[model samples]
Target: MSRLAQFAVFGHPIAHSLSPQIHQAFAQQFGIALQYRTIDAAPDAFADAVRRFFAQEDGRGANVTLPHKHAAFALADERSQAATRAGTANVLTRLADGRLAAHNTDGAAMVRDLTDRHDLDLRGHDALLLGAGGAARAVAWSLFEAGVSTLTIVNRSPEAADALADAIGEPARVHTRYWDDLGHIGSFDLVVNATSAGTLGQSLTLPFSLIGSRAACYDLGYGPSAFGFLAWARAAGARYAHDGLGMLVEQAADAFQLWHGRRPDTGPVYQSLSTRSS
Candidate 1:
């Protein structure tokens, strides 16, 4: 048998990631044999770990998550426009010449999941993005591209939110507010939770006033980490409440296509995982 292609996801606290299963499902669709592993590396060890992994001849590509996304972008020899725009990369592909290329699939995938899967129209919607970390940075531009009229960013650290807004370079359409000001900022048509509170087993304690009568609330975290925000949104009477599972699957599909030159159907995989998560 020919050697199976090697791929992996790099992140801290990686045991909870569904990347391996998601990618394996994609590979099965094409009768492609591949192995996807999870490498838990702290910030200090990330670059070295990636170097070691790609040193292997079969190391075809890698999916970067959480804290490692920006690191992966820096480590890459080249970057896609999406990566450059986001200032981070979630997917890394190994080129024929042995150099790694970085791509950011997070924003595009989230947009697809919202517009295609959930039928949420982002055009002209006033969106509120909570958190200004890597996750927020990755998807902010895409929200604008999807035609949101305005984006209000809030983070625990006001400076961080300001930095993200400045990076977006849209002083008119993009604005920042202190985390404590969420309650006073008024309601939004679309609310997104991009905070790590969920992953860290904490709650945002968001005010009910943030949800408009017809607002759609989405959390960038999935599984157990998403429960708190989803529950809050539901209690606040959000018109639509969704976890990031769909986005996760969509992003993985993009990464799969990037690595394999074929796009796998994500419906079955997403439904299967949804059942498991439920």
Candidate 2:
């Protein structure tokens, strides 16, 4: 019998992750038999848990999610440029030398979905990014690199947004807006929701003026919870509103490529998940 290749996604509360299903679909495309699972590792146990998993002969790779991306970055022996810029890692693969290499695919995934799937031009476009967490940081640098003329980050904790903007080091181009001043901000071509509001079953209110009829609003969260932001965007008169399902599929595709050296088509899997959800 062939040895079963193994992979998993790690997080503090991982029971809800769709990663196993996504990876299974990707592997099936190439007739590769693999076993994927979710590992609920506490913050203090993350490092050891990851080390043991990769030490296993059958382990191929792993995905890290929420509250652990930064720890994964520290645990990696080598890191990708994306990971270096984001100061976080979400994908990990075992190297030939028995070391773990890390990569951050979140930014690339978001950019691809926005430009390729949505066909929204980022060149010289104004963008508003909500939240100042890891997800926000990962996409901020990528948005800037994609040629967004002005990027304003708004957060409940203004200090967090300020620190992120400072780290990007282009104060002239990037700015931070206080949460209370969201009403005064002008409409942006694109508004990205990177906050944890959805996870908390909460929604944020922004001035109607901040969402032009042609604006696109995207939330970096998925599932039923993500509906909150999408609903708000639609109510606020956004022309295009969407959740993060596409981003999830695209990022997982990148992770699969890093581990297996083969990129699977994600369209079918994305449609399948969407159909199931609907």
Candidate 3:
């Protein structure tokens, strides 16, 4: 048999990643043989690890997560519009000429998961975004693309949220508030948690008043990391609440399509993982 295509995901504290399982399932759907690994690399080692993976390990493509998304964006020789818009990249492809191309699927994934998977209508909805890191930037862009009327962003470090709003350059539609000011922000039709607080096992202790009676809440963390916000959302009476497992699978499908020129059906894969996660 010909050598299997090589791919991997790079992140810090990567032991909990499900990218390998997700991608392998996708590959099996198309009868494609490939190997996907998870590489744990701190911020300092991210670039070097990516370079070595592509150059020496015959890596055809890779996924980036957490603290490494920005580094992946910077390391790429070229970027897709999605990456440029988010100012970070979650997918990296190796070109025939040995150049690295970066892309961000987080935004598209979030949009698909919310609108398609969960039947959440984003158009004209007032949305509240928590956090301003890599995931938040991408999710913010997606929410706009999905037609959220206004977006309020809040973070522990207000400067980061402000910077993201500035980057979006939509002063009229995008706004920022301090994390402590969340209680005064009024209710929202949609609330998204892109913060690492949950991933780091910290509670945000957000106000229940932030959730409208018919609101939907989403956390951009999966498994145990997603339980905190999801629990809070349920207790706050959100009409719908979900973790990022669906988004993760959706984004991985996007990356898979980019790398393999085909899209695998996400339903079975999501159901399998959801079962395991639950």
Candidate 4:
């Protein structure tokens, strides 16, 4: 048998990431041997860590996460359209010529999870996005590309939120809302929580009025981290609510395809994770 394809995900505080499990499961479906690991590297050391990983004879690629997306974008010799649009890179691959190529799979994964798995089409829908960090940056442009009628971003700091909206560059469709003005903004067809608060064991503490009685809710978090927002969605009378597990699976599948040239069946992987989590 051929040697295992070596891969890893680089992030700060990566100990809790599910990327290794997700990628390994994807590899099993294709009968492709692979070793996936996680590396915790802060911004200052991120570039060096990436260099060391790719230096390995068999080191193929890595997933970029949390505080490293923008750095990864800078490290890439080339970038996919998605990465360019997002101004970030969550998927990085070692090219044939030894150059690093970057791609942002977060948005594609999210759009697929919503439209294909959940049957939620964002077209002509107004969405309220929470948070203005890397997670938000990687997926906001994709939301617009997926045909969201409008995207209103809110963050604790208005300046950060405004920066993201400005970068997305569609004033007609993308706008920023200050946290204080949240009460005044009208309801939305969809509300997406992309904040890292859940990861930190903190709750968003958002008012229930943000969601229209008929709106759907999605939190870009999974497992226990997703519980807070999801519970709030239900308590607030959302028509539908789901966590980001499906989005995670879909995004990992995109990265896997980039490395192996085959997309594994995500349904089985998603079901397995759900069952295990439950």
Better of 1 and 2 by lDDT: 1
Instruction: Evaluate model 4: give its TM-score.
Output: 0.94
Supply the TM-score for candidate 3: 0.97
Give lDDT tens digits, candidate 4, residues 38-79. 999988999998998898656799998887899999999999
Clashing pairs in 2: none
Model 4: how far residue 147 lies from native, Å: 1.9
Ranking by TM-score: 3, 1, 2, 4
Query: What are the per-residue Cα lDDT tens digits for candidate 3 across 23-90?
Result: 99999999999999999998888889999999999999999998889889999999998899788999
| C-alpha TM-scores of all predictions | 0.97, 0.96, 0.97, 0.94
Steric overlap count per candidate: 0, 0, 0, 0
> RMSD in angstroms, candidate 4?
1.7
lDDT against the true structure, per candidate, is: 0.92, 0.90, 0.92, 0.89
| C-alpha lDDT of candidate 1 relative to the true structure | 0.92
Compose the digit string of candidate 2's lDDT tens values, residues 108-223: 89989888878988898889999988888899999999999999999999998999899999999999989999888888988999998887778777777889658899998899
